[model samples]
Target: MNMVQLERMKNDKGFIAALDQSGGSTPKALGLYGIAKETYTDESEMIQLMHEMRSRIMESPAFTKERILAAILFEKTMDLKVAGKYSADYLWENKGILSILKVDKGLLDLQDGVQLMKPIPKLDELLVRAKDRHIFGTKMRSVIKEANEVGIKAIVDQQFEIGAVISAAGFIPILEPEVDIHTPNKEVAEAILKKELIEHLKNLDPTYQVMLKVTIPDIDNFYEELMNYPNVVRVVALSGGYPREEANEKLKKNHNLIASFSRALTEGLNVNQSDEAFNHMLDQSIQSIYEASI
Candidate 1:
């Protein structure tokens, strides 16, 4: 199948596997890993909203100009059956504008009912599908070698299991720090920030900034904490989940140095600030960070 088709059906399994295999194994590491998973919820509602948003995606010219694309947020199962039902192009020899590209079978148990669209080499084999899918730009970010004309990078919502997202999309992740079963929390997310310390500061090649779309009680505290890590590629605080007035108020003290999203879907302002706008605003913001860091 072609890569375009892969993007349509791709999901975030690889991303999770990488996080699980971070090898830190320390209490702090394990605790941070768990925090990444805190934001995860079942994909039922999110999936439903994705379909609605997809129909409306091409509706807005601004969103289209931004190259805003939609992606599947997988939770274990790559139900080819469902994919076929929604857009059978996934199984066909020909991948389409709306088809599945990459998949994260790393943490999945096919015997447990998970089926991968394009199987990848587990155990660090790196048997990537040349025409299947691209990769996530954050974390498992080794796609620069393989990135081609068709290899448009991608970034899925942050997750405890984000290796798959990075593996398939090649884009940095945008985080919502409150609590989701699949995203990184303050401690864990902040902990990962340490990777920047003693590392490449604006010297990581593509870019050195770190892009994390998150919420914070105090942007100053969050911003200040980042100062300790001079190795950061760059930091973007996307904490629109808080009360708009409050979020704006908090960020105002910080300044516009970081590109923040108002928790909007890029289609409209977010209410209750649910992640329904993920594919467009969050996804796009994360992509910006990936490019900026590179």
Candidate 2:
């Protein structure tokens, strides 16, 4: 682990840029960025376009360490380059921002009111590659759709189990057990998730610290105590499906939790915009999220 990056992560007054949308979510991401699905005929072409979009964002002056503590990257992005340097290296060496790789394959079928991560075959091999690329951490996401105790416990257990592996590999893990924002019993699900998370966090070894990325809670300061846990490095909120304005408002009500937004961060940015227009829109987005964070 890089000690400098670790300290910044623990104390930075900024949000995380979640630029890690994967194959399953890429088309929608691109479409929102003004590239329709019909424009890309195949998956490879689609991925390349997505990379181009990400590269544009990374190279923009508006996307910098001033308001962004770190960036979460997809596996393909991790392997690619920005400005002729590896993506992670470019983020750290040029922009002074840390990098985290999204390590989960994707979600499994919804079962027990939740969706766990698909099995990551040869996860250690992937970790080895991430480490070689100057990655500071890793993120994996699972979802909670209901308040079922059995289901929520299973989700937290799976997150912590994989988190331990990532920790042992020398990368901090951002364990994300996202509660569905549209779930009918959202608050109940969040309460159950908090309970399950606390129980697992209590049992974690002192040497293994982790970060958390969760949906903005229905109640203000719902995860405040979780943020103070000795084993927790930082607690970040995912934008989920919330639009940028709504997400920023809700994030401000929660005292110390910072943003790790994907869609909300890129809400108005389109590939067709000129450099000046794109940078202006991105600047506005970053500023709003940064203000809400602090």
- State residue 48's C-alpha deviation in candidate 2, in Å: 1.0
Model 1 clash count equals 48
Off by over 4 Å in 1: 1-49, 64-131, 135-210, 214-231, 256-294
Q: Write down the TM-score of every candidate.
A: 0.34, 0.99
Model 2 bad stretches (over 4 Å): none
User: What is the C-alpha lDDT profile of model 2 across 82-132, one tens digit per residue?
Assistant: 999999999999999999999999999999999999999999999999999
lDDT, residue 200, model 2:
85
Span of ten consecutive residues with least summed lDDT in model 1: 12-21
Question: Cα deviation in Å at residue 159, candidate 2?
Answer: 0.3
- Give a tens-digit lDDT track for model 1, residues 1-294: 234423432321111111111122222322322223233354453343333333233232223212222222232112222333332232132222222222333322222111112233451332233122332222211111111212111111123234333334344433322212123234443333333322332343332223333333233554545434433323344433454344445545543224333222232323223456533554554344323222
lDDT of 2 at 269: 96
**All candidates: CA RMSD in angstroms?**
14.5, 0.7
Model 1 local distance difference test score: 0.30
